[model samples]
Target: MQILNVFLVIFLIVAAIMVERTKDLLSAVIIFTSYSLMMALLWLLLRAPDVAMTEAAIGAGITTNLFVVVISRTRRTEK
Candidate 1:
């Protein structure tokens, strides 16, 4: 349990950095979705199923889709 906690913390830190440092809008959105999934897992491990489900739905599902849509619409027309 303790080892898993430490690893989870490290993973979260790395994931957060990846999400922020990623330059491509599409890649950033994907990373953000993954980050949300990680957060949902952490919430589940903390025995908060409701919050986990909410995070999964709102953060991973809806928010990610919205981001993708926005990015797709705003994609630059490279000549």
Candidate 2:
């Protein structure tokens, strides 16, 4: 249990950094979605089921959908 918590924290940190580091907008959105999901899981681990549900719904679900829609409307660049 302790190890799992530590791993989740580390994974969350990496996901956050990755979201910022990614140059592609789509990839960054994907990473942000993963980060939100991980946050939901962490909230569950911390005994905050209500917060977890909210994070999953709003952070991962609605927010991600909005970002995808916006990205689809914008022009993409590749290196």
Candidate 3:
């Protein structure tokens, strides 16, 4: 479990960096959503189901939808 936690942390960091470094807005938003889901999983692993669910609902669900909608309304690529 400890090793898994460490791996998850590493993955979260990488995903965050990817979100920042991507040249495409849509790709960045997708990576951010993935990062949020990973965070919810980490919360679950730490025995916080309520927080995990909240993160999943707010961060992964609504926020991702908003990002997608905004992306669809605007440009998909970043300058």
Backbone clashes, candidate 3: 0
- For candidate 1, list the clashing residue pairs, or say none: none
lDDT of 1 by residue, 5-72 (tens): 67777888988898778778788787788889988888888899999999999999999989888888
* Deviation of model 1 at 39, angstroms: 0.5
Q: Is candidate 1 or candidate 2 better by lDDT?
A: 2
Q: Compared with the true structure, what per-residue lDDT tens digits does model 3 show for residues 1-79?
A: 9999999999999998999899999889889998999999999999999999999999999999999999999889987
Off by over 4 Å in 2: none
Best by TM-score: 3
Off by over 4 Å in 1: 76-79
lDDT of 2 by residue, 43-72 (tens): 999999999999999999999999899889
Alpha carbon lDDT of residue 5, candidate 1? 64
- For all candidates in order, the CA lDDT equals 0.84, 0.92, 0.95
Model 3: lowest-lDDT 10 consecutive positions: 25-34
